[model samples]
Target chain A: MKHFVDTLHISGIREFSEMYINKEDCIFLTIGEPDFNTPTEIKDALKLALDENHTHYPPICGNHELRQRIAKLESMSFFESYTENNVIITNGATEALILAMGVLLGHGDNVMIPTPCFPLYQTQALLTGAEVSNYDTSTHGFQLRYHEFSKHIKENTKVIVLASPNNPTGIVYDEESMITLHRLMEEHPDLYVIIDEVYRSMIYEGEYPSIRDYESTIDRVILVQSFSKTFAMTGWRVGYAVAQESLIKQMNAFHQNLVTGVATFIQEAAITALDVDTQFMLDEYDHRRKYLLKRLALMDVDYIRPEGAFYIFIDIRKYGMDSYTFCKQLADELGVVIIPGIFFGTEGFARISYGANMDSLENGLDRLDQFIREFCL
Target chain B: MKHFVDTLHISGIREFSEMYINKEDCIFLTIGEPDFNTPTEIKDALKLALDENHTHYPPICGNHELRQRIAKLESMSFFESYTENNVIITNGATEALILAMGVLLGHGDNVMIPTPCFPLYQTQALLTGAEVSNYDTSTHGFQLRYHEFSKHIKENTKVIVLASPNNPTGIVYDEESMITLHRLMEEHPDLYVIIDEVYRSMIYEGEYPSIRDYESTIDRVILVQSFSKTFAMTGWRVGYAVAQESLIKQMNAFHQNLVTGVATFIQEAAITALDVDTQFMLDEYDHRRKYLLKRLALMDVDYIRPEGAFYIFIDIRKYGMDSYTFCKQLADELGVVIIPGIFFGTEGFARISYGANMDSLENGLDRLDQFIREFCL
Candidate 1:
């Protein structure tokens, strides 16, 4: 095995889950997938693609039809000048991040990301022999403080990764925060910023902000979007990268050697999914978010109100145990699953996802509250 | 962009094809996709998965039903001890190769491969910072002469890539040859061998030789198989890697950060594709191979007769031009397309795929003969 590969470890989520997955009957609050079924129109489109024999190698970037749709889609959001060439369909945002980093960062190069962000950014950057400079944002309630750039930014930092409606924390960056972030990126003209908006369509409290809205930062940012959260197509393996043509072309070149492209039928379905509204899920998730928040306000738990996505990150610092030990014991003693926030690089917290059904969330949170009472007291 | 990405060049094959793909009335002998559509049963299975709402994230390795089927499928060929745990379903054979190389190799490690092989291997190895040692096999009619392994074997050579029914050359390794190859591998227990059998099911001659046929070398080999070439599922994004449990676990961990897994509907379809009999395409390909051989015999051309797959690699050296010039001129003047051998690491030969319809192959080869008569003379 290569020395570098030995250094690459599985994410903390996988490590803890594997230890207890087969021991069923536990209410898993660690769910990242949505509980909704795929929309019928999308499935119909997939059937249509298969019937049409769309089963050969896709264009190295993606099918131009899908690309055109994605370009149109992005133009409505943050990119007015985006075109078919700007988007490269990927297996998912994960592959997009891998290709973007693989093409942009190398040895001696570095990426600056907020702590408690997705571990994928760190892992892929490491795989490319790049270093990571993580800004511990836990002190700021998991929101970006661009003024702190001088604290973590290094001379070799080549990319900045910002995830809005972030995993675990559900921190959605609005236009004001994004403008400051964009200004920070403009100051570092040599650096590229990656904006992960996989949960963009699901934002409940505020509008999703894209760096592309700022012309100065648009060329320097690579926007990644996913159909998994919005369309409930996690297993369909469809997502795309939206960026300037020159950057996308380079990323596409690297991507061609990694994957042929996403499956054609899946892409067709995703294209159809573009027309389907996501308001239903947003409303459902908002309900769940409110439900969880109401209960937390009544309890002794310390938590920041989740603004978007499906997670509520709660600090367990008052309890003597670390988040990992607390979550592990909670699951072992009770029948609920929550991820330790230490997994995301902040030690005194844990994340519980409300992406499950109301019943499971209710049952899981009840068990969690009881465990907190017993363990903390 | 990273300096390495800028250093990577577009392939010669693309350079030539792009110059002629738009010119009308062209006969394309450069097709690599099968003429047959995906089997109806496979399509039906994909539809079933979609209807069943198999749209959640799959296990990092794969869905157990598909992996179990793959294990059973592989055991019939190269590995008897293979299990569901040993198989990691990938986006395609491209990703399988990437994960295999990334997990098993690193800087200072070397991979030895024969010349005139797939450029993907070299491109990916370079991306991973591994050195490539190319052994020229054009002198030996493109067959592996096992006795010569000692000359290229180095203390740092960690991987040997062997492709049977290979791309461009179409040479299948028979059982006797594989046994000797196995014996050679047994001597170097430290080296990992990657056997790309994407075209294994398209064999026309005798049985395909696998290192797994002999148990001693089985543990050290990573077998890569694809549904694209055999089942015409290229656009479906389905393939898999079979190796030891520990290695597969590592690969799957890496895969988690690259792709979640193949789409669930695609995996379900692939499971049905397992029962699909590919005798018809094999028969058609054999007929085309025979047709190509018969025409080459009468033409004033030098060539190696292909034993399997859908290509005929003909020596264009006698035409008094490098392959790029010959192929480019042929496409421009004769209105026919073929890939230049320079793209495959050999300079004097060109590859013509017979995977097109009979009419196109017939028309293209006739024009090729006329080009030889006019240009060679």
Candidate 2:
């Protein structure tokens, strides 16, 4: 086995999910996927594609129509220069991040990612033979600060990864942070940023504060988007990345050999997904988010108010237990599963997902409250 | 950019296909996909899965039921010890190959492939920073000879990649060759073999002589299979790899972070695909293959009889032009597209795919004949 493969282990999030997936009556607040099913229109489109015999191999990048649709949708919020040529549909945002990392990072290069980030980013960076430099974000309420961001940069730093409506924190990067990141990129002309916006559509507040707002830094940003969250299509494994033509071309070369693009019929369906109304799912998640926030507050737990995505990272340091041990005991004793913050490169905290059903969330919170009282009080 | 990404290019086969894709009245024999639509049963299963709302994240390795079905199906032919733990559902055989390569190979290691071979193998090996060692098999009828294979083995050669009913040549390895390979493996205890059997089900002749027949060597053999060629599910992007439990665990770690897994509903549909009868499509391909062989014989072109896959590699050396020039001129002047042999790491040859309809095949052969008479004579 290669040294990297030897060092690589299954994601701790997956490890915990698998551990309790089959436990009777367990309420899973550990999932990162939306509980809702995919919309009917998208499913119908896939069936229609099947009826049309769209079963042959698609273009290496993706179907031209799907790329065009994606480009049009993204252009409205980001760079107007976006075109079909600037996009490559991937297996998922997972593959998109790996493709971007593979194209940009090599041996002796450094990829800086915020601490308490999506775990896959670290693993994907390591697979490319690049060193990972974690920019700890817990200090700034999990937001990017200009001075703190600059402190993590090294001469070998090639790429920086950020997630809007981040995985564990659920704190959307404010416009000020985006501007701060732009400043950092300007200082390091060679730096590229991979902005994972998989949770972009689920934001409950104002418009998504996109980094592409800075025209000068637009070319340096690779936007990773997915239909999984908003459309409840996680199993569909369809996502895309938008970048400059030259960079897109390089990523496409790796994408072609890696998975030969996403499923063709799925791409046709994704075009339909771009037009479907996702506000209903977002509304339901916001309802759950508010309820969960009320419950957590009554328990006197310390947590950042989640503005987007479906997670709330709550500090568990007061309980005097590590995140994994605390979550394990909760699942074992209370039948409520929450993800350990260590899975996202931070300890002494745990992430609770509001993507589950209201009943499950209610039951899970009650159990979590009881456990916290027993452990903390 | 990474040096390897800079070095990689879009496949030559895709380049020619794209060049002629929009050309009116062009007959394409450049595709490696089956012309048949995916079996109806599989498509219907996918539709049913959609109706059932099976659209959430599947297990990182794959859905448990699909893995069990695959293990059950593969065990009857390969190793009876095969279990669900030994299998990983991938995006396709393409991802399977890259995953196997990624897990087992690293910088300074060597990967040996027989040529003329699939071009992606070379690129994927290079992506892992491993040096690719091509053991040119064109000198030996594209079959493995014990002494010839041994000559290419280096001290650091960690993997040997082989294809049965191979992409360009359509030649299946015989039992004698498998025995010779098994003998070589006995001498090199650290060596691993990745046998790509994507076209395994399409063999028109006798049973496929798999390398896994040797129980001792089976542990080191990673078998890659696909539904694309067999059930005509190319656009579906589903395939699998089977290895010993330990190796499968390592590859699954990569698979989890790489693409998560194949689409969830697609895996459900793949279960229905396993029971699909594909003899009708195989019969059609064989009929076209026989017709193509007769046409080539009448044209007095040197070629090998394809035993399994739907391609016939014809020698174009007599035309006094390189493979690319000959193929380019054929498509431009005669509106017939055949893949240049150089795409598969050989020159002075061109590959004609019989995967197209008989009408296209007849017309393509006619155009090829005209080009030969005008240029070769």
Candidate 3:
């Protein structure tokens, strides 16, 4: 018997990480979940929602308040004019990504995705019976080159999944690249562009330029973002998508039949997140990113330095071991957990998240240094 | 220009109830939700979860405490043995149904669903690209006629979707029907059964004989139930499914990738719902069920008497209009809102929920009588 669809085999990086890591002692840096508690204001807002009897169903698309907050936030940050009708709150950016693909692609349609990206983009495409073509960025310092991306855009391409402060690699797309990408999107009027800016607030240097900046000029762009990273609310699982009203209508119908809506109480609480608490959490991540980068410099590791987000993709190829084996052996020997690069389809590197507390990071790095000296040498 | 799948159509029930109904005078009987607020204890539990900082990601299957509570509650209620491992909490019974269908049915598989049932069973099948064959129970007073059901069990039939204390008609499948269904299942080893008991606790009559009672002998049954109806926690969006280890394993994988689990605070609150305050809510539903049934009797409406849940399906063919037009005309003219029977795949009928306050029920019924006298005749 066929246990699962052939397309369902598109696996996420975490599966490979799970196989190599031991349960008992591995201090693994595998998952992308934020390590901080949900901000106090967001937590209190959730409590207020519950207290105020916001427990029944809200609108299937989203509650009006949260949608309004999302619209305001998008306009203020990206200068993109969006309305409540143009936004649909989702379970998370994961669901938003899936719904976007479902709305845009039919069977055998092709979607271009960045390699060394979050695996979900490609996985969702396969699940929809759509083919995923990867534009490998490993040689370009894990950055999208316009010519390379242009080569993959063919007649059958229905969508492109782009992530900024890209997952696993942590490289934010430069403005020129984004503009060039936007220009190409304009030429292909039939193609849908899905920009996952889930890590939008976590940028370290240059201002985040959203593809929505081209919205007044471009016809097809969908923005997917989440509170999970920005408010340390991964467990809270709240997110929203912004698109044209026409696209949102179909997404809303999918939302209606999929999960109805996020919990009303959660929606009410998330209003506080979008309005007040996200920046503070992002500031904390910025501090950690600087601290971890300094430590990497001291260790003399070869890394494509991140311009945004809290991950450092340090090359462990010099250590003469595969990324997965190195990650496990390092965790077993050093009492520290860092995800192997193999999970992100980049086998020679390992990704370390600086999202943990200073004490843990300091101690874990010290142990990592000791292990590298003993094992690599 | 085609935005939607060709096979899909917008649900007309939602279209009318949300759009056509007048705000000024609409007294809606089209409610698919319980009228009562979530119980104070459960609400307090939610508050406690927030206060104690339970805002982290719940385990993908569920929190252990809620899983244990579900195991205990359903085991005691149905005379079946279900360990925590056998249960997987979902967003709602809707999600449980979706996940069950996703895991069991690949493309081209056939799932037998009872007609005049909740539209989701068929919708989920459609989403999976599976064929949905209906067994019309309306002819047999909405009871599952074993001989008719058995005849539909051809070689291609992979599953059967059954609802007890049926949704639209409110007829409970009696013990005799359950025994015969069980016998048929015994003969067809390849067929899987998805029994939706979301309304099991709302029943007012003879013992709710669950397929769970035969779990020791039946290996292929999946039981789906919810806290929405029983505890008036519709907005809270928590439900669970119990099945054999093999099925739970596959469903758990999909559930993990789907929503990453239900909200933790809500799960904690639901534990209180299952363990502490369930009986009181069940008794209240029983009371409302009797009162509403009595009112329907006095109103001289032609209806199939409901055995359980808070709804009564009244045959309105006597009203001389289609269910959709009749419901709108009644709501607009008489200030009462009721769902059209066409929403649940049967025409010439309307489903009126009794979960509202007695005063509203009395007033609504009086208006209903007035509408019948003036409009129907």
**Top-down lDDT ranking:** 2, 1, 3
Q: Model 2, range B133-174, lDDT digits (tens) per residue?
A: 987778888889888789889899999998997879999988
Q: Give the per-residue lDDT of model 3 (tens digit) for A187-282.
A: 787888899988777887876766777754444888898878877777776788888887788877666655667888888888887666466667
Candidate 3: stretches off by over 4 Å: A1-26, A77-79, B1-10, B77-80
User: Isolated chain A: TM-score per model?
Assistant: 0.96, 0.97, 0.92
Q: lDDT of each model, Cα atoms only? A: 0.82, 0.89, 0.77
Number of clashing pairs per prediction, in order: 0, 0, 8
Give one digit per residue, the lDDT tens place, for model 3 in B193-300.
899988887777777776767765456888898888888788877898988777787777666655667888888888888755566666766787777777767877
Task: List where candidate 2 sits over 4 angstroms from the true fold.
Answer: none
The collision pairs in model 3 are: A27-A337, B27-B337, B28-B337, B29-B337, B29-B338, B30-B337, B30-B338, B30-B339
lDDT string for model 2 (A1-377, tens) is: 27777778998787898898889889898878998999999999999999999988888899999998888888986546689999999988999998899888988999999988999999889878889999778888888888778888899999999899888888899887888888888999999999999988778776567788999888999999888988999999989999999999999998987898789999999999988998888889999988988888888988878888999999988889999899999999889999999889998889999888999998998999999888667
Model 2's DockQ?
A: 0.76
Q: Judge the docking of candidate 3 as incorrect, acceptable, medium or high.
A: acceptable
TM-score of each: 0.96, 0.98, 0.94
**If both were scored by TM-score, which would come out higher, candidate 1 or candidate 2?**
2
lDDT of 1: 0.82
Cα error, candidate 1, residue A2 (Å): 2.9
* Candidates sorted by TM-score, best first: 2, 1, 3
